[model samples]
Target: MEDRKDSELKTFCSRNILIILGFSSIMAVIALIAVGLTQNKPLPENVKYGIVLDAGSSHTSLYIYKWPAEKENDTGVVHQIEECKVKGPGISQYAQKLNDIGTYLTECMERARQVIPESKHEETPVYLGATAGMRLLSIENEQLADRVLTMVTESLSRYHFDFQGARIISGQEEGAYGWITINYLLGKFTQKLTWLYLKPNGGDVQETYGALDLGGASTQITFVPQDKHIESPNNALHFRLYGKDYSVYTHSFLCYGKDQALRQKLAKDIQAFSAYYYVMNFLNFTSEEPPSQEKMIDTMEKFCSRPWEQMKIYFGDVKEKYLREYCFSGAYILSLLLSGYHFTADSWKNIHFMGKIQGSNVGWTLGYMLNLTNMIPAEEPLSKPLSHSTYVFLMVLFSLILVTAVIIGLFIFHKPSYFWKDMV
Candidate 1:
């Protein structure tokens, strides 16, 4: 009778112990899940702002850029948030009326004041960079260029933001920065080469695209050439980006921009063709599938042969001054690319005329801002192997799995002897 009583007591205790263990395992899993969820909550983002004024030959434009303060060193972190084109011609054109510089820049500066948060105003740095137009003016009259830049600097100083200086950037600087902008926007700088190694003639890694920038007063071409040896050291630029070194070939042709080339064509007494036809509209030149060199010449020839009166009727909306210049601009662009730059018929397909990339205008301004701010570090920043959320999720998943295994083992151990025998 004592043996029976002891056996009952032992069985009751064993069952109660299994129940306690199972309950504890479930509670542990719940606690782990709650802790993980609480720990994985996102933190607030800290952002920074910058401003660049591209005082181009034809016009002046203001660009506001922003990035996460923590990720400033990362490639492509900075991006244009706002673009305000300053009213009136290029700041260089304001040489005669230097006093009006401040007033002229007011509208755009006001727009900037409205766009950026007031708290960030004092911290945001503002910069102005004049391109070829000012460069030409400076060449003709150095004192006058200096005066113009002085006025521009003074004008920007009135704003609430931190004013960086204003100056005319060299053509070489222009070309190199343009190359950096495109490559950065395209994500070429930080691209991984793991999958590219398997392909034959893939050249061990991804190659960067060449930059062809055409503006009103100058044009620039920059690229990484297959041959490392550059004959013209003057045209060579070296950069260390994302821990990789690059030897880039870049050249800027002053007075070769579309507008300047058109003037040159007119000065040479090139015959003015039919009036009022927008060349892009008539030739379909700006389409996704651009026309071949031969197709372009053939189309231009047929279009230019038409009488002025007939062309006017077809394109009444276009102004007479611009209509007369279209043919020459088109032909000049072709000549500049083929003769001036030495691009071949086969290689012409590689050239891409892009106005913007990834919502930001492709230009030297962003690169210039990046350089001055030291936003892009020489060495890459360190990062965690796994994101916080991922780590937390994995921990929870594994804990649940462990708890399940323990429960299963406890259940089997507590089973009756007959349960195992039936399975066998």
Candidate 2:
């Protein structure tokens, strides 16, 4: 009778302990789920929009950019949301027919209106920056340039956006901005603390890639030189970005763009083909793995030496005008890069001919907008103490550990006989 009574007591205690442990485990799991659900909720995005119209020599392009309002000062935060190419020629071309400029910009403005929310339209700042074409026009006729800008500003003001005024940007500004755009997109400006030792001399500064921009009316080369002393003060631009000071060397050559260069070459040399990009593309010249100078010359000579009538038969789809200037255009590009820019064969490998970077067109327009709006802060923004994921993970891990500890403590207190049995 005593043995049976003891057995019943043991069974009762074991059952009660199991019930408590099960209940505690379920409660812990419930708490963990609640914590995860509460902590991991997504926050609403507060976004801002801006518009930039890049009025180039050959054409005009409208870019709509958007970013998180809180991250406006962060590098690579601004991105192109929409790109609209104006159907007509560049605004500079409408200098004589100034009245038509409004109509020309209407379609793009309407598109911008459709893309952005109606509530944000009034707050969105619109900017127009005319490049080399306008610069040349301004040089030849300052009054005409002024009139063109006035007409452009008036046209843009008709929209609901906050018009920031339109003006011709200097070549130096163009070069510097292009460099900024490239380096910014490349994420060279912001360096993490972990990467400090990787840099030469164990310095915190990051190496920046040089920018080579080729446009319709001009070409710009900008980079931070190895030597601290710059010979030409006019070509040097100093910038303080993300808590780092940069002294950059930049130069923009007017009429050195493929189109203008082709015209100059055609006037002086024999013109057999007219298309600049089309011809080079046909020869596969515009690629990351470009041919050596000797090979490029050889290829061009062979292609240009082909009989004109046979060429017409083979490539009849191409325009006669563009078909005749291939050789001269090719030679001019090589000479301009090699001789004019002084890029030797050894340094030439580093040059990357990119039309776009990270889905945005590589140009001075993005950089121009960044400067005007003060998007790039002079100092680095403070980072958060803990990321949401890391916080969540730590909370879950600690909760698990606490639950395990409680379970072990309960097991030891209730089932001390098991431990004694194991030891024996």
Candidate 3:
């Protein structure tokens, strides 16, 4: 009777164990199928586009960016789809002939119309942001700058695209946007850039990086300084990205740009060189007082007309003494970074000059588009839905765990009946 009872108890436990194992296996298989189905589903055909015309000091470039409609709110989703270079100096150079500025953008704007899908033209926002060149032009001759802007705006308005605006962006905006562009390209803003837009009151951010940009007419330095106390009020910029707040220091030296600085230096050098010649002429004749200031000015003007104008006269026939002011330009850049920004020797090495980040050019244009279109979401999207490979890995991991747990439970509960069974 005792032997029979023991056998019955073993049979009951064995049956229950088999049922549990079968159920777990079925559930695992079902879960895997569900995951597979979800993973294989076709992605939606919902793409949105935008166009940005970067009117920098040296040149102009048109960038067309696209992102999935569903992912518009996510950060770093907007990517450069196509970039077209405008075949001339930046629009600011056309300040004198403002009408010509409108005509010059014809080819590039037409290219944009062709590149973006016909359907997207009406919805797609087109923005033109002029950099240092326009900024200087505005400061020097506000009327001319306004006329140039009007010309470009009128030209862009004719296009099918939603012409947003054409104007000279502030130096602070340029620096901040460039910083955002780099960090976005580098995948630093994984979740949300900051809670800036959503919260009207204020908030903080996740992480940020420094950005250093060098352009023909201006240089910008921007970074979230560790120390909160900023000496210069103009240099300090306050931003709230995603939900995080950041205090960044940014400075743009007007005449310190590579091209302008080089021009200024060349002008000074020519004046000095011409003085040497004048002194020789004076010594050869009689020791009279040097020529008047006006004459000296006239001599300097002969050498310092535009660099190109000077090049035509001096370096037209021979290319021997071209780019002589490079040394002065380099020195000016160093001084701007060191003495102007108060960058120490140790920290100077950390500064990075980025023309491009990843595949896209590191400029303010991308960030500008992202901001206007609300690409950087206030809330984090579901952590990039797990990849197919990740799903497979996780499924296998759980299956193994289930099997191991079942086996351990069975062994713990059901002891071997005989010595021979245990040995087997």
Candidate 1 lDDT over residue span 96-174, tens digit each: 9999997999999999999999998998888888888898899999999999999888888988998878988888888
Which prediction has the highest lDDT against the true structure? 2
Cα lDDT of model 3 by residue, 30-120, tens digit: 7777777776677545677889888887678889998656553243367887888787777877877776776798898888888888988
Write down the lDDT of every candidate, Cα atoms only: 0.71, 0.72, 0.66
Cα RMSD of predicted structure 3: 13.8
Pairs clashing within candidate 1: none
lDDT for residue 407 in candidate 1, whole number 0-100: 66
- Once fitted onto the true fold, the runs of candidate 1 whose alpha carbons sit more than 4 angstroms away are 1-40, 72-76, 192-205, 264-283, 373-424
**Compared with the true structure, what per-residue lDDT tens digits does model 2 show for residues 1-424?**
9978866876676667666766776777776776776566665556678898888877788899886565432433567788888886777788899999979999999999999999989888898888887998999999999999998888899889988889888778888887877776776665442222232332566788888766667878888888777899999998766556789898988977766865632222111111233445767876868677677778878887999999999889966666777666667766777898887878777755555566776777777666554542333343444577876786788588557857765775777668445645
- Candidate 2: stretches off by over 4 Å: 1-39, 72-76, 191-203, 264-282, 316-321, 373-424
TM-score-superior candidate, 2 or 3: 2
Show how many residue pairs clash in every candidate, following the order shown.
Answer: 0, 9, 11
My TM-score estimates for the predictions, one after another, are 0.72, 0.72, 0.61
